[model samples]
Target: MISKTTIDQVYEAARVEEVIGDFVQLKKSGSNFKGLSPFTDERTPSFMVSPVKQIWKDFSSGKGGNVVAFLMEHEHFTYPEAIRYLAKKYNIEIDEIEQTSEEKEQANEKESMYLVSEYAQKYFEKTLWDTEPGKAIGLTYFKERGFTDETIKKFGLGYSLDEWEAFTQTALNEGYQLEFLEKTGLTIVKEQTAGDTKRFDRFKGRVMFPIHSMSGRVLGFGGRILTNDKKAAKYLNSPENDIYHKSKVLYGIYYAKQAIAKEDNCFLVEGYTDVIQMVQRGVENVVASSGTALTPEQIRLINRLTKNITVLFDGDAAGLRASLRGIDLILEQGMNVKVCTFPEGEDPDSFSKSNTYEDLVLYLEENAKDFIQFKTSLLVKEAANDPIKRADTIRDIVNSISKIPDRIQKEVYIQECAKIMQISEEVLYNTLAQINKKEVNEASKKIRQEQKVFEVVKNDPLVEKVDVQYELERKIIEMLLLYGNQKQKFEDLVLKENEEGELVLEPEIVEAKVYEKVYLDLQEDEIELSNEQFKSIYYKLIESLNEKEDFSVNTFLSGLNQEMVSEVSSILMEEEQYVLHDWERREIYPKEKQLGVAQLVGETILTLRCNLIKNRIRKLQEKTQDQHDDNSEILEEIMNYLQLNKLLNAKLNRVLS
Candidate 1:
């Protein structure tokens, strides 16, 4: 367990915007920061981080919390893991008690794989620097590739000894199970004769490049053999494991994430060396496909940072053709992709090594072509002097354009393609239309099949209705969070029996804290929220207000678990987002809620009271119909509730539905 002092130190040191900003591209929106929702696929910014409150909320997914919670939700980290990540980010020393054997055994499979991968990364680095064979072969190979010691260490470059059991034996001696070892593909385990097992290292005699997740955890490795052995593969990567999916992982993302966000553009290369070499040469906003085809998941990873990606091509004809396929995928994700080809004889690794940082950047900027231009120029040459091949190329380009989600972008690309192909714009549009129609039909069929599966559940008579008061309960929580401590004067309407023996409303002015008024009103009406989660938070807010003069959202959130933080964040951010909408630009200026805090707070509590009274009346009417029940007292109480309900409805300007 991490000590409380360490956790507090982490929380105080880590700023919400600064921490989330590393993973997300956040822009200043008033006092808080706003960015596209990393938790969901969104075009507009719905994820908000409040620097003053030191908490973040994703309105789209309804996930919210402090910095640690964001890491857990985004990275699927455990509680202690999230705390440790924050501590590491902020450079705070973690005071953790060692885990027992039972605790060690209780770790999940994925975490165990992670542990093994991390251990292997460390072991490889030590071997590369500390051992004779490692230095002679592995270190020499890296130096030959022109990677500096600092660059290699920055990217966690390592080496595994050539011996079969070198790494495997070390891991076993350290108490790591072979189960995780084989699972992470670090140890190759085989059954030997006489019911014994044989284990060997998977990456023996190879210079290792550690693949890391966005938050800098070692996921796996990509190793390249230095020896010219005809039988062995030149490059071998860790097999697909619980922790590392090659298609989903991007090489050097850990080192490049902040630079990508800060530079507002990601530089895409094809190899691990390309990314590291470029970063070493001061081009930091770069990542590699790790020699695999680009996946949508990987694009989405970059999409969280910026929409603009400039894929650095090796300039070899075959390599460029292979990388072009990912451009359509990038377009489909609504990202603006550009291509930057190095000189015909060079790749990013070779080019960066030979040129200065300024020259390399200049070359990239000068040579970068938008995907449409690059595709047209490259393909048009292939279709030279052949009309049929040209026509086929045009159709191919049209199909790529159709994959784009944004209509405006599709139209713009259509125009650009038509002009370059010297074809009429109408031709491209017709081709795009046919492709779109086919896709729509296919999508409709899929939707119909999915809908049929859910139809029975939708029509089930046993489906429970949502609680009617949830909205009001949520609003009550919102009010308390926003303006609970503010002093306000409210018009307290009192019901008195007049000479006519009828209840009359008398208005009286009362001044008090908003929470004080809300508490008193709810207590007098004997009302409580029906939703257990909302009820818990409502009381916590009140208790915090009662105990402290200065209420801190961060401090309040520290006591709650992730789920409660999400619930409270949803309540608070729903109001914040509602307020953020620029209605004034549409000539619909909304009245600020703070201008009528007393009325807003009073109405919220009154609405809750009104709902409770209505429910009571419903039960009373049901009881009145019972043949064996005596309901005289119930009817009298119902009449009093009805009178109070009318006064509340009048104040709210809401007629009973």
Candidate 2:
């Protein structure tokens, strides 16, 4: 467990803009910074970070939170993991509170697996340098492959000792449980005759590559055996476990994520060496599928960084066939896919190593083809002198184009495809329309089935009634957040009798801070917010004011949980965006709601009280209509509520019919 003091230090030292800037390219927009949202695919920037509030908001996805929350959301880190990451980044020393034996035993399964994987990573790296066989074999193999000492350390390359029980014994001596070791595929266990287990290392005699999550935590390892054992597989990977899913993990993502976003493009390769080699050669925005078939989940992972993927393949027949299989999946994700084929005998790893950086880059620029052009040209050659084959090839190209979500992009591709295939645009349009209509009908059927199931549950009598005052209560909370500490005088209407004995109104100004006025008004009216979230925040705000003479939003935010912080950030950031838009420059002035902050606060409380009283009057009338009840008290309460409601309505300028 991380100590609370260490967590506080991390939060205090880490700046929101600096922490989030490592992943997204932020540009200055007035007081806040705006950038393309990493959470969604878009050209226009909607992600905003406010240094003043120590929080960020993505208007596109409606996700707003503080620095810690951003790490947890963006990188899939746990709360403690995110804290530790920030501490490491800011160079803060962590003082951990050790867990008890029973507490360790009762730890979450997924986290235990993660802990085991991390320990194994450190163990492998240590063995690679300290052990005799590791240094002679593992270190030599990496150097022979042309990896520099810096690159080896950057990727956390390591080696496991050739002995059977070296790693397993060391892990056991360190008090790691056998169950987690077996689950993480770090130690293989076999039952013995004496009811004890025999354990062996899984990556024995192999050089190790630690695959990391986006936050740079070790998820699993890919091991390559050095000895020429014909019977054994050349490469081995960890089995599917709670912490690591092979289909969702991308090799070198931890190192390449920033470069990918910065370049606004990603280079997709086929192996770990390819990614490492390309990155080492100055093309930093590159990742690989770890030699697995490209999955939709993997494509979506790259989609988070950028929408453009350029597949690098050796110009071999089998390699080109394999690379073309993934283009449709990329198109389905609404991403643009381009293909760059190297010389017939080379891959990213070999080619990057053999050629100069400028030569390799120039070659890629000249040869890169859009997916439609690549697909059309490759297919047309095979379909030569056969009309039936030519027609089928055209349909296949149209199918890929129809999978694109953007209508503008689809139209553009269709025009290009028609020109290449020597077909009329009208024919291609009709084919695309038929495909779209079929897809729409299938989607509509699925949606209707889901709605039928949802409607049954939604119509249940157990559903609670909607509270009408929820919006008014939220308005009060919003006002306190925006103008809580400011001092303002509010005009209270005073009713007096004139010479004619008719009631007349005069304005009396009473001065107080917004927080004090809001608290006193709510207390006098005996009103509480009906919404639970707003009510909880109201009390927290009051407690904050009581604790400090001058309240700062950043200080108050430090005490809130993740959910509350996100809520407060969303409220605060929405108003900031409005101001940054600067509508006044275009001769369109937006009304300043905060200019009458006192009036807004007073009106919010008054409206809530009036609504609550009207509800009470309604209940009283229902009781007065009951046949079995004594109705005199209910009738009197209803009459008094009616008079109070009428007065409130008059004050609000509502005509009573």
Q: Cα RMSD (Å) per model?
A: 2.6, 3.6
Residue range 1-657, candidate 2, lDDT tens digits: 777678778777999998887767677787789877778766567789999878899988999889988997887777887888899999999876765556657878877787778889999988888888878999999888888989998999999999999999998777778899999999899999999988899999999999998778888999999989998789999998888899988998889988988888899998999988888888899999998999987887787667899988876757665566799989988889999888788889999898888987888889999999999988899899899999989998999998888899999999999899999999999998898899999999999999998998899898778766876777787888778888898876555777997555566899988888889888877877776777888999988876787787777776788888888888878876775566778898877787778878767766787789988988777777765767887888788777667766777788878
* lDDT score of residue 366 within candidate 2: 92
lDDT of 1 by residue, 23-58 (tens): 888888777888888878777788888897788888
Q: Candidate 2: list runs displaced more than 4 Å.
A: 1-9, 21-52, 57-64, 96-103, 192-195, 447-465, 493-507, 530-533, 570-592, 622-633
Worst 10 residues of 1 by lDDT: 575-584
lDDT of 2 at 219: 89
Worst 10 residues of 2 by lDDT: 96-105
Q: What is the lDDT of candidate 1?
A: 0.86
- The residue ranges of model 1 lying beyond 4 angstroms of the native Cα positions read 96-102, 443-466, 579-581, 654-657
Which pairs, if any, clash in model 2?
A: none
lDDT against the true structure, each candidate: 0.86, 0.84
